[model samples]
Target: MAWKVELTETARKQLTRLDKTQAQRITKYLRRVMMLEDPRDAGKALTGNLRTYWRYRVGDYRVICEIRDAELVIVAVEIGHRSEVYG
Candidate 1:
């Protein structure tokens, strides 16, 4: 079953801060991968304090998300450059 993808308000704002092309790429990747396939299979699970989240790479950008399998929802929590995303 296809999953529903939702972006948090903060994530939406973060995407606006990115370059147009980069934002588009990230959005496309999220739709194609996160929505169509099992999100856990599309990205690596995050470790340490952020263990609850998953990370999907789109070039230099990182898409941080939380997957809810029971609800079939993939919520994008944050989106930013790799260097700043984790911080």
Candidate 2:
């Protein structure tokens, strides 16, 4: 099965603020997620929230998103440095 990826406004803003390395990291992580890797196999989210789940070590950044629509899509709401990813 295949799914569609959507970038939220927060994520779009975060992308512009990242350095080259950070951007690359985010891209790589997004690819893995696009391919639909099992969440359990992924690393910790650093800070676990009610609506957001984290997929850590997305290259060098953290991917903070929510699983919705029966897990057929991802709302990549935020991407940022590990320290800034949560909270």
Per-model TM values vs. the true structure: 0.94, 0.72
- 9 in model 1: Cα distance from truth in Å? 0.7
Clashing pairs in 1: none
Worst-scoring 10-residue span by lDDT in model 2 = 43-52
lDDT per model vs. reference: 0.89, 0.67
Residues 24-84 of candidate 2: C-alpha lDDT, one tens digit per residue: 7777766676676554355454342443464546655776766664867766777887777
For residue 64, model 2's alpha carbon misses the true position, in angstroms, by: 0.3
Candidate 1 structure quality by residue, lDDT tens digits, 1-87: 888889999999999988899888988898887556677877999999999999999998899999998999989999998999999
- Residue 75 lDDT in model 1? 91
Error of 1 at 2 (Å): 0.6
How well does candidate 1 match the true structure, expressed as C-alpha RMSD?
1.0
